[model samples]
Target: MNTRPGLSDTEPAPCLRIGLLWHSVNSPNLGVGALTISNIAIMEKVANELGVSVEFIVLGWMDKSFPVYVQAPNVRALALNGRACKPGGAFSAAVGDCDLVLDIGAGDSFADIYGWRRFLYLAYTKWLVKRAGRPLVLSPQTLGPFKNRLARAIAAFLIRRSDLVFARDRMSVDYARDIGVSRKIIETTDVAFRLPYEKPSPWPGPKEKTVVGINISALLYQGGYTRDNMFQLSIDFPALMDRLLDYFAGIPDCEVVLVPHVLSHRAVEDDLSVCQQVQRAHPGVSVAPAFRSPSEAKSFIAGLDFFIGARMHACIAALSTGVPVAPLAYSRKFMGLFYALDYRDVIDCAAETTESALEAVTLAFGRRDELARMARHSAALAQDRLGIYEDGIKDFLASRIPNRRPAPVAAKSRLSA
Candidate 1:
């Protein structure tokens, strides 16, 4: 270890070790992939510009046997499941050398809204990071609508101890304040907004017609398909999707394309199958090619004239690419993100009736041109917001390096060398 006490204003600090935990880089959800890659790229750029090397210990490597999508020489992927199995053995050994720990938390696992199991997993990970005696940073992600008392307590405990917590939207910031957290909290936009998008040369459908992209979530489709919801509000999901397809199909010179944002290795969990079912039901409707990465999916979305999506990331992929979207929001995360972007016109599946959702979708489709213009402007602003997050991260890293002059011993060694 370089034992220099502090970095000078003129010179770069020594190598810094950072461990980024709690995000599955290889998740079927391409948005997760985008976040993972963006986080590493941002940190690496900061380190490189400062003339310091960074060793990233990525704790949420989903499958070590398989190649990680976010590949870098400095990034080391340690399987989280394997680490959990070994308990203190692997996690402690892997993270012991880290100077700081960043809990990315897969965007929105900080609360127990999904279930108690997820909350427990996140709590345990935060506890481990806190125990390491390093500055624990909560990367830009959604905080909570923690209904459970125990869950709220755990979240408050972990968040209070965080050196820095970057809430992706104002709602999350409000959430942190509601939970009585006094820690340093900065409201930032989703890092995925900064993901690179390339426009496809020949758009997926006919050039004469408008290309509308639809992304369906299999998880949502399976949970009672509308009249029944895992939550209180129930709109038949499949019926709603069918209605949207029929409405668009009736439009002159409009092409409907089913775009799956998640292609799980597991057959049942995959969005591709759900998209196919929709395609089969509608004769002229087409299914987009299975995308290999988030950037690829975003690129496909870039080719669309309009997008209506059930998956939050797919909506993100669309909005980030300046494609107009009528997000079928099933959770608060969607509302919060769109709210931050100042982009309204969302169809809340959990709150709206089938007729209301259909009306919203119809209005969105009819005003696609105006919505597209707004989306482009919003995306430009969203990308700009990422700069704030970058600065925050850089400052956090720099703070860890003391401001004092290099130790006499280190200075002597440098002089001799």
Candidate 2:
């Protein structure tokens, strides 16, 4: 492992300079987008505590410019024009100057056709690490089933070279070990654990007896599977929707909210489409507006009595906010998250989803007290895991940057407090 030697204990620097490499900058996908935002926020806190300056190097064209609210004194977003030009050199250039570099890998399902490499972020990061002397830390990320031999070989090489590697699930930890990632590897939770949950919007009418929330991504429903398979999923989804409406319609106080997790032009499992169709079929259920920010989406979900979702982040948002969630998994990442949070009993993906979802929702509602207990447990566990992630970054930097001072106490207080 080649390490840089600018910041040593004898001559410590005032602040550590960090470069963050992320694939989706302006994406509307709530899970990935929220992860990027939350990761930046967490790093900002970490940086402040350490008196570090952080620069986010986003690698794509965004529908909108960088968000103004995310701009702060310690962080800066650098758009690398990833769409029009290759970002390998630019990523290398950015990493070369920083004390440390953090790369967020595509969680599990790395070999899927719609996996992370398809976006070119990993490829660029690999190149950047090869050219730069700074130590690299692979954050708590999901590993792939690795269908592509070439991509897998490259990923294996990168993992082998990283100073520190943290897998988000046991499966990923096992996979990384199998792939020869022999360095310091640890199991940790997703960084989104640090996000603060807000209360949901007030209901326009009297509160319903049960407010069921459902979130889905059209992209997953569109690709990976065959046309026949997708058609089946589409047909089955609507049928399931009807069954749910009929089951809850007679309850009088029950309502449904359909949340579209990703609202982009290319999105295919259109949550809006599902919401519209269900609304038209069942006139009584009311759907909430499409949410754009993580705070808004999470707040809306926080109000639900129960949440059912195909998107992992949607389920995460609900769970993080103390709302009971039954995830409809499309990939291993979903199952990994559920298992990590000890919510395995509640997960049901599209392949396995059926009338059973309705049953799960009912069961979850019945066990609200138990689920609440589990929620607190999961939150504490998530907090402890985040500490591991923070420590991993600190250790990686300390090993490489000799003069790196301990993160400033006042900055750390302001961010973490």
Candidate 3:
């Protein structure tokens, strides 16, 4: 970890430098984009409290399907993928220039499930940061389902090296310990809980109808990246989707809108493409216009009366906004996160048959009001959980960055003074 000499009686430094790893505001996967936007907001809040201006360097890859949103003067976005991660490259200089490096593993890429290419890409960058002697913090995220001994060994090493580690759910916490991570682990909620958004000015869906927003993940729809039932799910995804659309159509005064979260350019990976196909098949269903930013997508999602999503962050967008959601989960991350918040409305594709899954969703729809009430409560709890994460961040920054101003003393209260 890098440190600066104390200012003694002098005021704090003019700028605090931070390097964000494995994050980009331009990712086609809006889930990663949401993490980027929300993290910046959180850092800004803490910076205000410390009475300091922050100069952030966002070091990550860029996806051509999306436009860059980190255009703020305080933030410098650098695409550091491929050969750019070497010692003398921009990635190294960025780490050297910053006071701290915080890695989120793009929220879940720390594991080997994505294959060696991605694992190496993420791991090598962390190695660069450490070799540069910069302090690294692993922000709250799903740590791993490593599955391979070597991958688990590497993950455990990184967890051990990080100055501060945070796991966003109980399962991640348990996994961290299982991997021999001895550091004190703080359990916190996802940062997306605090993502800022504006409500849609005018409701886009049909008025006086139950507006249901559905997010379909093209990756899952195509059966993982291979399009050969890669995840080995017992239920048929295409059939399930068809059934959902037809079933929702049967309800009187109900409208369904397809909300695509991943706007990848590749046809198989792009959610909007699948959504367009759904629109073609069911002419009554509407597909949302492509959003320019994560906030925009979340804003549109927030306006929905009810939401069912395959994308974890899209579901998060709904949950954090107090809009009730039923998550069509295919991963442990979903079950861990939702169940941790005690708002269990996740319909798992692995465990239940299509009929059983639909039954659960149907029951949840009937109890949407109750779900909404629980969602409101859970949102509050999410913030409360985030306080632990916030405090850890504050303590880390305060220790490294000197204060610009003195703490104010409180005035004594009087009964009638």
Candidate 4:
């Protein structure tokens, strides 16, 4: 691995510079947006405590400019013109100067399930950072079920190069082990747990009845609702939704609200479109308006009495607020995160049949009280897990550069004669 000239632990640098390499900050997925904001907050808090001048560099010149909720003077967001990732390019120059490089990998795309192109992009970024002689940290991310050797090789190389790696769930940690990542492997909860909750104005769901939030993902909806994924749960999702709607409708004081997490402009990738279809098909089902930020979306989720969602982050929002959530999980990430919370009511869409999915949902609905209590406990636990991440971050920073001054101590009081 290439080494860079960084400040020694004994040397106090007046300024600390970090480069964040991952998906663009502007993301249509609210969950992605939430992660970006939460990460910045985490670093900012550590920087303030260390009493060092901190600066941040984020990749720019993306096809889409998603909204970011940061206004810190210390942080600078710059766009790399074109694909200037090659040496001597503007992008390379910008990141090369930074003291550290942190790859968030958009939280979960460390695997090759998406495609080799996505996997390669991340691997190349790691090589770039290593070449720059900066310490690289892999933030809380899901590793993978690499079906191909090439994907595994790329992932393994990145893991080996990383100075520190944080896996949000045990499954990811195990995967990292499988890839031969032996050191700097730490388990930490998702940063979304720390995102500030902003209460929505004029909440859309009915106040008179028990509000049940149901988020539908465009990914599954577009995939023809099949069981071809890593978890092969045979399901006809539309029918499952109908059955769920029927059950909720029978409850005298319960209301069902369709929450769309992804609002892609493409019809096939937009949850709002699928939600509209469900709204028209079901009499009692209501649809929520598209939210502008993750804060607004999570605020709406916080108000729900119960939540069942396909989007992991939407379910996370509910869980973080102590509102019980049952995830209709198609990925292992859900199983891993929910397991950490000790949440039992999950519909493993990849592993179970439609009938089993329905049974799981019904069981979750019947046990809302138990789930709510567990959620509260989990929320507390989530906070504690975040402490591990904070500690790791502070330790990493302290090793590079220690605080210049120690806090002043007060003189002892003199005793009266």
Candidate 5:
């Protein structure tokens, strides 16, 4: 095993080369879509402290029309165009000369339909590493229930062979254990926790009234969950926005702002549709424009009296800033995050949503003091857990790649020798 001076080590060090692997560049919610971006941002800071050089390899098909480039210093972005690189070619191009390969999970939207294609990407990467006989580390990632047997087998095989495994939650830890992945398995929080907090909103407005914020995703509508027959739910969100305006109508000074987390694709359009419906219902309700940076989004969320959203990161942004949040969970990640934070009481999604969302807001208002306390505690917990992830990455590198020279002896000891 190799050893190097990481942040945890008590010695100075040489620069290290690190490779980051991810699937896509564009994301509707900058928080969710730019997870790799967040990871790289944190690593850049850590690497600078530890004297390491970092390079990013984004593995997926490239659209020449929409070339994506990571905009960070000392970081090079490699786009392995899908057609030419394929899985094998992408893996080789990404990890060929790197000292350590950090395998971030692939596009999660594909997993929504129980698609096996996501597993194929992971399996192929592992195959490449084994073929080259190099070390590969699995970062804090979300594993699947594996609806397809072939996908499950492939995932299991890869998990078993990885040099290191760090699950983002307890559920992932259990899943890996169940599949007989006996490698090092540790639980850590999402890497996004390390991202810098966004500043407060600059716009001046009445500071007394509670500002209710909602981040809606269009994916729900497209997935048929919005249809009355499919989900047996009648919350025509656009219409419901009107009802909410009516509900809050007489409350003096209270205002509503609909924030769209996804600003592009069908999801963005869906969010816009909901916004338009709300605007039609109540002509005066103010709506914020799509935010471009995670910092700006976080800052906006921090000023909210309360937040309700289908997107996980929207809620996370609120929580990260000490604002009370109620998530309209559309996927397991939503439930997983709440459970990880031990805030299952705050989430209301799909069938469980409805008036409960209103009730949660009321509770958030009533228990504002308690919620603030909990938020402070949870934020600290998030910070500590993130430290574990940072330490884990450095330790993995130190153990897998030893330092070239041994520790120096004291001058007195050397003289005796």
Candidate 6:
């Protein structure tokens, strides 16, 4: 066989080229990072079991300041952003080269609630992959809550075209069916549940007291994106955070920590800013350090005796690690995922009053030992449920790629060394 130019004869070819759409290994939102890390673990496992060499091409919202940190030699991030949507751009070429595309829709971007821009971003990625005649798979993520006709149609069209659709919760499954999409939907738990974390060595804290962590979403702190209660929750979010803090502060020997999950530079998206402000209002409250990766955030949360948070993934990090967690739910995704895990110690922020929500959280904290038992039990259930998803992934990857292949060119643009 003639050696292709620029391709050394000694270099082994990758058996498969996989494109992960809406997958960002580096993001201020640790939740997104959690999904990215968990999904990659699955892909790597599937590839190894199939005896295939795989190269992952991660494509999503990338910025120069936040370089991709995939921590894999075979993974690379394309510099192209929205420009990749065009027919003749590098994204198109990247798609044409891929053997398969796994789109997690940024966990729940398949829903129209975030805005038209995000929905279209996900829709176009699916459309372009299908147009390129490549296999498109919807990695386990929330499917939909498309409010309008146009959004519904667009979502249904992509869901229908996808080679496989894995819904992370039952509500997503129901919503997909409601939108007239029944086929190709596999119900599973959030990938964050399976996200890996490092066990932190004993961190210096008041060892005799209950160490509590509260993750306050800056978006909700200022009343959603518009800063005017855009999520339409009945309760006032700012008031709830204030009340929870005061309640915890009054408890003797309780060491409270402000943990920020979404660390975006954008004022509204930056949890650290809000957490700092929160700490000032109530002195003696410690602030958690800014973590470089999702695993780091999970590890810090793992040390907490109890965690209550508005961010679903932050709560997930706690509960999944056997820390008693009471999720401050602002959306249906919370109820869907946790309930499916057989964990019901959730505070419905969307529906409850600020006072009532605080009350529920206080009650949950009072039952810390019980919640810990349930958290451990739920973690076990999560493992059992996630096993089904792992099996599904194994079958899908095994059938998609052959055992033998010619050596392919190495990726030029790398996310991390």
User: TM-scores of the models, in the given order?
Assistant: 0.88, 0.82, 0.91, 0.86, 0.79, 0.92
Q: Against the correct fold, how does model 6 do in TM-score? A: 0.92
Candidate 5's TM-score reads: 0.79
Residues 113-161, model 5: lDDT tens digits: 3344545655675677666666777776776656666666777787777
lDDT of 6 by residue, 358-396 (tens): 889999999999999999999898888777788887787
Better of 2 and 3 by TM-score: 3
Whole-model alpha-carbon lDDT for candidate 5 = 0.60
lDDT of each: 0.77, 0.63, 0.83, 0.75, 0.60, 0.82
- Per-residue error for 299 in candidate 1, Å, reads 1.0
Model 2: number of backbone collisions: 17
Query: How do these models rank on TM-score, best leading?
Result: 6, 3, 1, 4, 2, 5
For residues 153-204, could you state the per-residue lDDT of candidate 1 as single tens digits? 8899889988888988888988888888877789888887766667768645
Error of 6 at 7 (Å): 22
Per-residue alpha-carbon lDDT of model 3 for 263-365, expressed as tens digits? 9888877999999998899998999999878888888898998999999999999998889899998777888898899889898888889899888888898
Best by lDDT: 3
Candidate 2 TM-score, C-alpha based: 0.82
lDDT sort, best first: 3, 6, 1, 4, 2, 5
Q: How well does model 3 score by local distance difference test? A: 0.83
Q: In candidate 2, how many Å is residue 110 off? A: 4.3
Candidate 5 residue 80 Cα shift, in angstroms, is 4.8
Clashes of each: 5, 17, 0, 5, 4, 2
Kindly give the stretch of ten consecutive residues in candidate 3 with the minimal lDDT sum.
408-417
